[model samples]
Target chain A: MLTCKDFLSELSDYLDDSVDSEIKAKLEEHIKACPNCWVVCDTTRKTIQVYKGQTECSIPLDIHARLMAAIEKKCAERGK
Target chain B: MSAPGSEAIVSEESGDLALARTGDAQAFANLIQRYEGKIFRLAQHITQNREDAEDVLQETFLKAYTHLDQFQGNSKFYTWIVRIAVNQALMKLRKRKTDRTVSMDEGIDTGEDIVAREIATWDPSPEEQYGREELAEILDSAVQSLAPAYRTVFVLRDIEDLSTEETAAALDLSIPAVKSRLLRARLQLREKLTKFFKHKGDDAFAYM
Candidate 1:
């Protein structure tokens, strides 16, 4: 029987699909029986999903323009 | 089939890389335009300050331009530059040296029975929460609360959507190490949000 500690230890690798099948079966079994472990696993997975759903932002325009100017100057200096 | 013009862009980028290696500053600048947004965003997230991120942006491309020979085309150009930007941002953080050095083993000692905090499950779902301005702020702060080690891996793996192998390559860690850090980061962020929602009572549970 995989204890909660063991299940938690392998949760990352399990969710990531890096664990072997035999151990994976054991983890699934344990989480099925363990509500706390299930909460840990489910909430962690949901958290990742939520974080991924956040909007993608960019650097400000003036900052980007300044970056271009700065890199251009450095490239120009290298040209000299 | 290939998204209309994706093939052309790839081939064009390859040509640009070739030209860039041969001292074509214009070609290099084109490459910069292609990836500046991604690299800049990565820097901004890692450094968590606009000015520091801007400096990292400047330094990353400057180093890339000067070290074009170092690139061997084995990895995607975006990945290559992202690795550089990560290093640059990490270097800046190191100079500050205040709280940048979060031990990778910190808070990972949950080897006993797990305790489930009274975490309110989201109502409409996290995808729906995307449009809520306050949730966005909370999300950002939740990520910001993580130590740098976990934060960088989370951004690279989850936000940037890099594969585990790619993230391992970028951070120069074993794939297992990447997996562990990512897991811890997710758990910590979840606990933080759970507490936030539990206390607020009405934000995450409004639909319930």
Candidate 2:
């Protein structure tokens, strides 16, 4: 049986689905019996979910226009 | 996608790519339009400042356009572009003298340093019932608190949804290296958030 510390080391691969099936089962079993480790794993997963859900802010219209205009200027220069 | 053996291939991405490669500025602009917001978000995440992130975003496209011919088509165009943006973000961070430059192995040095601490799990969970704006603020700070090595991996892997191999390739780290850093990053973030979420008003979850 892996200790909580041992589970901590491999928690990422286990969550990532990168762990081999047998080792995954063992880690899952450990967390099931261990609330501390379980919270650690669950909270981490939710944290990632939260981060993934962050809204993507659009580039302001003026900045976008300036970028396009600058690129257009460069293209015009190449044509000259 | 054309029929497997057909000579005529189609995909606006590929079509735009072809034109962009030939110095067609409009085609390149089309490509940038699709990706600029995403790349800017990535830059903003890593540089942790709007000014630096914008600089990275602009420089990434300028560099990509100048070297468009060097892009191999083996990867999706956005994937190729994102790799460039990641580099630019890192360069901007380094220029600020704020990059932590530690690999997972070197960063942890010895795993023994992380002592276990008891933490209360919030009954309502964080994303539930927490005001959306406040949660967003906390999430941003938590991510920003990570060292550069781990934060980049977390952004690329978790937030950007880059595959492990793709994240590894973009960051020039080995597959195992990427995995380790991402794991460490998540653990540290979890630890940070546990403290932030533990103090819900008692009645908020009395029903549970």
Candidate 3:
């Protein structure tokens, strides 16, 4: 069974996909038996899912166009 | 100006930096076009304001262009670009100290209180009220609330998906500083969410 310490310690890596397959398997097996760990996993998963979704802000087309122009202008100036 | 995946353009950018050093305008433009989004996003995440972000993006590209000749081929181009963007964002943030003081022992204010109010007003059905998207938005706001000192590390490591060493290199902070700040940021976010759940009761995560 995975204790709270084990589950919490590996929680971030599990979310980040940095944990090894062997440890992940152990975690999955433990979550199957431990409701507490399962809740931790569920909450943490929700947390990461929420983080990634909200962090995505579009790069405005106008801004993109302006930045490209600036870069082009810089390049042109350097060319001279 | 060229097709995004134009083979010719791709090859041009992938060609020697010596070409870029020798004033290859198209090559430099290609490099900037390729990296502008990521650079803008990094700045936006760090500064949490589009104006500041735009400034950071401009500064980053200008610095990169001026120092293009100094770049060794060891690190990835985007990595170097991000380093410049992060620096610009941090510098801008430091300059804006009068904007919002990260008060120690800061009491809950309108921003968080409003968030809590909305969470409290959520529908009885957790699935309906607290969907994945809602949760994510709340988490992002929590991250945005963190002081610049903490927010930069959290975004660079978790949000931007940079490795510890890469984050350290970008911020010019020690690895231990990055690790410690990242951990503290995550803990603060978790605590904030935990309180949200505790206050909101069943509507917070009854679906799970």
Candidate 4:
């Protein structure tokens, strides 16, 4: 059985699935047994989901066209 | 099926980057089309203004084009461009420091007052206000109010979904620095969000 500290410490790694199998199993056991730790997991998952949705910035089409033209202009200047 | 010409363009871009380093304008044009958006977004995130972001984007690519020969293969081309944009943004920030006025520490201190005012102004019954979208908006505002250094790391890791190594490379920060800053930023944001919701919840319960 993993301690709460172990679960908390490894939480990020476990969530990222970068932890070893044995530790992962222990962490899972701890989560199953501990409501407090489970809440941490739930909140972290929700937070990440919300964070992902919030950061999608829309790029304008004109910016792309202008950027291309600028890069071409620079290249032309450099070629001379 | 992939467009037959697309592969050629990618290959040509790679070759063009190589040729552009040796002074090839056409090749550099291809490289620009390939990377402009990524560069633009990186600049926009750092500067937080479209006009300044465009300036940084233009400056970064021009600088990158000039210094392309110095790009070692140690990092990806995208990473190199990101570095240039970040540096350019930082330089601009330093130049515009007078406009910022408040230091981050002072900002945080005063921001507490702002938070309090916001809380006070909210309709007394928050339980009646169950807007998940509103909660997200509050969260975004809180994030925006974070110091640029903290905000940058948070956005790179949490928002932009960059891996640790990629973020480290892009920011020229050590992995440990990236990890420390990321955790601290997340903790600060969480604390603010928790307080916001908890206060609302308490108010809602009190009215019941």
Give the top-scoring candidate (TM-score): 2
- Candidate 3 segments exceeding 4 Å error: A1-7, A17-34, A53-57, B1-13, B16-18, B99-139, B174-177, B191-208
Error of 3 at B30 (Å): 1.3
lDDT order, best first, reads 2, 1, 3, 4
Chain B of candidate 3 achieves a TM-score of: 0.70
Candidate 1: residue B36 lDDT (0-100): 82
Worst 10 residues of 2 chain B by lDDT: B1-10
Q: Model 3, range A1-80, lDDT digits (tens) per residue?
A: 66656666566667667789999988888878877566555654554444555545557998888887787787678668
When sorted by TM-score, best at the front, the candidate numbers are 2, 1, 3, 4
Q: Model 1, residue A76: what's the lDDT?
A: 77
Candidate 3 structure quality by residue, lDDT tens digits, B1-208: 1346667754555683556777776677767766787788779877888899998998898888889877876776666888888888877776786746432113223222111112222222233457677765666688888877778877877777678888888878887666656655665665566555533555647767
Docking class for model 1 is medium
Model 4: residues with Cα > 4 Å off, grouped in runs: A1-9, A54-58, B1-13, B98-140, B190-208
Count of clashes, each model: 0, 0, 1, 0
lDDT of 1 by residue, B1-208 (tens): 1358978988999999999999887898899888787787778777788788889999999888888899979987778888899999988877786763644344344423233454455443654544578777788888888777788889998888788888998889898778778877777787887765433444654677
Q: What tens-digit string does per-residue lDDT give for candidate 4 at A42-80?
A: 555544555765644555788767776887776567557
lDDT of 2 by residue, B101-163 (tens): 633333453456343463556555567757888888798898898887888889888887888
True C-alpha contacts between chains kept, each model in order: 0.62, 0.57, 0.27, 0.28
> By descending DockQ, how would the candidates be arranged?
2, 1, 3, 4
